[model samples]
Target: MPDSTAPLLLKGYAWLPDLRRRAHDVPAVPVRLLGKRGTALHGKEAVDFFYDEKHVRRHDAMPGPVLDTLFGRGAVHTLDGEAHRARKALFLDTLKDPARVAALARKAQEEWDRAEADWRGRDRVVLFHESARVLTRAVHDWAGVPLPADEEEATARDLVAMVDGFATVGPRHVRARLARKRQEGRLARLIGELRSAGLPPEPEHATIARAVAAHVDADGRRLDPHTAAVELLNVLRPTVAVSWFLTFSAHALHRWPEHRALLAADERHAWGFAQEVRRFYPFAPFTGGLAATDTEWGGVTIPEGSLVLLDLYGHDHDPDLWPDPYSFDPARFTREGVVIGRDDLVPQGGGDPAAGHRCPGEDITLALLAALVPRLARLPHEVPDQDLSIPLSRVPTLPRSGYVMERVRAEAPAPVG
Candidate 1:
């Protein structure tokens, strides 16, 4: 099989699906990535196979560059077995609390309301950049991190850079490395302070940072300050990354204006709209792990230690799974009696989040979007003439213009009957 690392880098999100198309739509497409023989799998059954711990493992699966840029070194993303479970428990406890999720969503809505007022006075605002800052401020407040107002934009940029640069070897990649280094250092210092002085009493709600700072691993050792900082970023960075989906939501509304009225009128439709945006937009192209042992799937043998990739983007866009997959149709999700199977949506990875390698922050992603999308729909703005083209060659790509809007105004309140 031909090496696909170059193609993947050059083609970005189009690489795997194109490969599958060329290969007569094989269930398992053989290829080489990073000089290692890898097999790519898709669909619901593939999700079950890929997430099974006995078949695949995450330890040593993520590349070093990805670790340095996206997930910090020793972050929970790289752990496996008992260590994985123990570390994952921290996220489940912090993120899975309905009260905590609701509180964060409420904070985000408040932040959006405040930001909307500021945007109204401006001639033009880039929704992507502004939404990122809004998310950063809200998550920081929720996480109990005292971010000075002056530093909020810079901090948000660093968080965005980390996600933006992880997949490429360019200036973006260098910026990502520097951002991670700076953030890890700053957070480590904060963790040290919290450890020594203990958490403050002002924030009655439980803070994720405080929980991570005090969490003991399966080995009965508290995470070192650096590791604790990494875990903290694991919470902070991904929450801020929700800005990407928010931006995509704006793009969707612009392209399909009819959905806006429905989304604004009904919160359920807004949630459905968020799910469709997550599915339609290219986020994570694929996720992979090393084969734990010899495994067979779709009549192909995956040797022990070989890389096994789940085709996330491809699966979401597969016509067999999503009829007219390319269409930006939120109704596919909002239709009455509709149910989204766990494995059917792999935008953030699939399978059981608590028991598997799937992102635990998935619920928070949905909640933040559910709260923010309707607000975006109700916000009055006009899409400016700019470069809206999303380049497929760039990993974690977005509209070149960052979805600019002009003459922003908040929605008018309904009059009493």
Candidate 2:
């Protein structure tokens, strides 16, 4: 197989889909990535195959660069089997509760409401950067991290840097590493203080920090301070990363102004719009796991220990699954009685979150979007002259202008009936 590391890096989200196109839409494409033979699989059935623990495992699958920047060393994302389940339970217990999710969303909405007023005073504001600050403040409060008001913007920038730099080997990657180091050190110190004798009691709703600090692993041992800090960041980083989706939401509304009225008038329409943004936008390109044993799927054999990547971006855009897959239509998700299947529409990973490596924060992502995007649609603002083109060749790409807007004003509340 030809080495595709350069092509994958260069092509970004277009790499796998382009390879499949060249192979006449083969079910699986054999190629080399990072000097290892990798099989890229697409479609719903492939989702099932890739997520099966009997066939593939996450241990050692993520590269060292990814571990240092994105998922910390010894984080739950790197575990397998019983150990994974134990660590995952902590996330599920805290993040999956309805009240907690609502609290996080409410905090985010509050931040957005406050920031909207501030934006009106400025000549221009980058929605992407501003949204990151909003989410950073919200998640910090919701996660019980006690960040000072002045540090929120810098913290948000670091969190964004971690996500922005994880997939590349350039200056962004270096920034991500430094950001992770700074956050991990700060968080580890916080964890130590929380564990010390003089700390106040954990609040009723602020359970994330306390829960992580006190969690016992499958081995019946508490996580080391640094590891606990990593897990805490596992919660913080992804929540703030929603800024990417929110930025994309701004792009969608700018490009298709017709949807704005529907989204602003009806909350359900806003939710549908959020789901479409998740599906249509380019976020995660693909995710990989190593074959635990020899596995066969789509008539192709994946040798044991070989890399197997599930094509998330391709599957979301696959014509067989979505009618007019290229169209930016939200109505496809709004029809009555429609529900997105677990193994389908995986901008995050697929399968039951409790049982698989799927992101436990998926619901949090949707909830934040549900709360914020509607506010964005309703806000009175002008999409100023800017480079709105979203280049596909950049991993984690966004509009070149960061979706700038000006002349911001909040809409008046509807008169009570």
Candidate 3:
């Protein structure tokens, strides 16, 4: 625990001692950078720096990190200008309507309903992995692929491992690569089927895998299949990467029970909790980069090619940006839940620090969580190890057994006079 003193950024304070302090000076404020080797960024200042386009270009350039090694540098996340827009455009047709999202949500709800029914009156059942299993199947179904019932967790783990993008230290890097391989194998088979179908070459085909396949050099040609394989992996990579946040949001509401009741009883609270959870439990700690050119930040000059990381967790907890930063008050989001159209509180880790990024999928995550978290809370059950301590490091993690939740049999409400 390095000092969180004046003008200093600590290595990782995911368990904030003074969330108020974070809400006070975050994002834009310069904190002292603790010199920890092979550490990921974990401060609001880092978030701001990460959001900067110039800084994003820098993040796009750095090597030895997670996503870069998977796709070599400059996939959609790294590319810029027309090239960026063009590549990104490939997914437009596939993602155009919200119908797919709605159907997926409905599928998820049915599963949650089933989980609650199965766990009624139980002590606790591990839910983190279970929920992952549920949502992964929903997304897999949307992708027009068959997701075997038992393999959902393994597939979800593989997806989470790939998007974790934490290569370079610990077993995290090794695990991520292994997960990538597992996922690549699964996606390869699916792609083969798509190829055999000979469907129209639209953006639907240009799913993340398709986009990677279609990504040509400046000359507008196709990339090798190996490169395309990584892109296919990318399609669902971040989906699971962000799932933990939704899972944590569900855990927070359940562990706190008050939020559960509040959300269930009030439409306003439901919407507000939706926003706060994303702010409070974002999965990505920060994005990484090396400056392309000299840049100015927090009154300090960053020399060309210095490593920069944008910590999304820190930004959500900014003391100045958010009142009682650590407190889980959802009122700040307003009724109907504030749509996250590039505000200061960015959890998806893109856009300008004060502006926005390419986090188009945020709505999808939020909508699903908004629907699911409240329902999961009403399950009338309790998880035994609700107090299982998660680390406050570069990224938050859960134990292998995963989280448990028991169904609490809801007593019939008395009739009101």
The lDDT values for all models are 0.90, 0.90, 0.57
Q: What is the lDDT of residue 13 in candidate 1?
A: 97
Runs in model 2 lying further than 4 Å from the true structure: 198-206, 413-417
State the lDDT of candidate 1 residue by residue for 1-417, as single tens digits. 778889999999999999899988989988799899989997789999999999999899999999999998998888899999999999998888889999999999999999999999999999999999999999999998879999999999999999999999989999999999999999999888887887655323457788877888999998999999999999999999998999888888888889878976788887788899999999999998999999799878999999999999999998888999999888898788878788888899998988988999988999999999988988888886898788988899998889999999878887789
Q: What is the C-alpha RMSD of each candidate to the true structure, in Å?
A: 1.8, 1.7, 5.4
Which is the winner by lDDT between candidate 1 and candidate 3? 1
| Candidate 3 to truth, TM | 0.77
Tell me the lDDT of model 3 at 390. Answer: 59
- Model 2 lDDT per residue over 311-384, tens place: 99998998888889989988888898877787779998887788989898988998999899988888888887
> What is the Cα root-mean-square deviation between model 2 and the actual structure?
1.7
* Inter-residue clash pairs, candidate 2: none
**Per-model TM against the reference:** 0.97, 0.97, 0.77
Give the Cα error of residue 260 in candidate 2, in Å.
1.6
Our tally of clashes for model 1 stands at 0
